[model samples]
Target: MIAREWKCRVPEAHAEGFTAYLYETGVRDSSATPGFLGAQIFRRPLIGKIELTLVTYWKSLDSIKAFAGEDISRARLYPEDEVYELEPDVDVQHYEVIEHGFIPGGL
Candidate 1:
């Protein structure tokens, strides 16, 4: 399994909008791709900014490349991202998942 993570900071005032955009774009799009296991979004407030981290699970690097294109290390960006992200990283980090478990909802 492959775990991909991207990090960024946005102003506190823009946090909600940025998060919504992330869900609308990354989460929605990734869910539609084959081999996309799932996605998680994390956030925390620091000073006057909000730090956002997006983690996505994939069955393999090839799956990620399908969604991310030829240069898989580069972070995917949308047109409106320029207004929300404050100094977002240009690249994403990928790791091999040793083990993972999740409980489905409706339990």
Candidate 2:
């Protein structure tokens, strides 16, 4: 099992919009792709520093490459994200899963 990670920073004002963009663009698209196991987004905010992290589980690097293309680095920006951060750069990191668990959502 593997979890791919990407990191970036954007202004707090653009946070919501950025999240919306992730859903519309990345989450929706990547989840639908083959070999896409799952995806999670995390945010870390400080007094004047904010960082956004996107973590995705994939079968393998080959699986990710198949969906995202040859140069698979950079956040796929949706039209909506333009209103948020002026520019977003993606730094990629891949991790091997040590352990994982999940609980069913009951409503």
Candidate 3:
């Protein structure tokens, strides 16, 4: 499996709206792709903004290409992103999953 990670920042006030928009766009769109395994969203409170990270799991690079086009390194943005005043990373990072499991009795 592969993990594709992308990050962006938005105003604290826009956090809620941006999260919903992310689900309607990134999460929903990626879920429809063939090789999409799953996705996780993380948020951190910053001084005046909220940082959001989206990590999506995929079966393979080819599968990612199918969804992200040939240039998989580039971040995909939606037109509505401007509404939230998003500051998104221009590129994404991909890592091979060496290990992924839950520790017993640990949450």
Candidate 4:
């Protein structure tokens, strides 16, 4: 499996709204694409801004290309992003999933 990671920052006040928007955009769009394995969204509270990271799992690079187009390194953005004062990364990172599993009794 392959993992594609993207990150962005938004003001603390916009965190909630942005999260919902993400689900509607990135998450929903990726979920519908073929070869999309799964996705995880993470948020960290900073001093005054919130950092959000999205890690999407895919079956292969070709599968990713189907979703991200020819340039898989670029981060996909939605038109509504500016409404949340989003500070987004222009590029995304890709990695090969070497090991993955859940520990028993661990959340």
Model 3: lDDT of residue 81: 99
Q: Give a tens-digit lDDT track for model 4, residues 17-95.
A: 9999999999999999999999999999998999999999999999999998999999889898999999999999999
Decide which is better by lDDT, 1 or 3.
3
Residue 36 lDDT in model 2? 95
Against the reference, the lDDT scores of all candidates come to 0.91, 0.75, 0.96, 0.97
**1-107: candidate 2 lDDT, tens digit per residue:** 77878776778787777777777878888898889999999988956546778889999878888767766664455575556664456557778898998677944
Q: Which candidate is the best by lDDT?
A: 4
lDDT (Cα, tens digit) per residue for candidate 3, span 1-107: 99999999999999999999999999999999999999999999999999999999999999899888899999889999999999999899999999988789997
Flag regions of model 2 displaced more than 4 Å: 72-82, 86-89, 103-107
TM-score of each model, in listed order? 0.91, 0.78, 0.95, 0.96
Error of 2 at 78 (Å): 5.3
Cα displacement (Å) at residue 15, model 4: 0.1
Cα lDDT tens digits, model 1, 1-107, are: 99999999999999999999999998898888899999889999899999999999999999998899999999988888978856688899999999887688835
Task: Pull out the clashing pairs in model 1.
Answer: none
Better of 3 and 4 by TM-score: 4
Off by over 4 Å in 1: 102-107
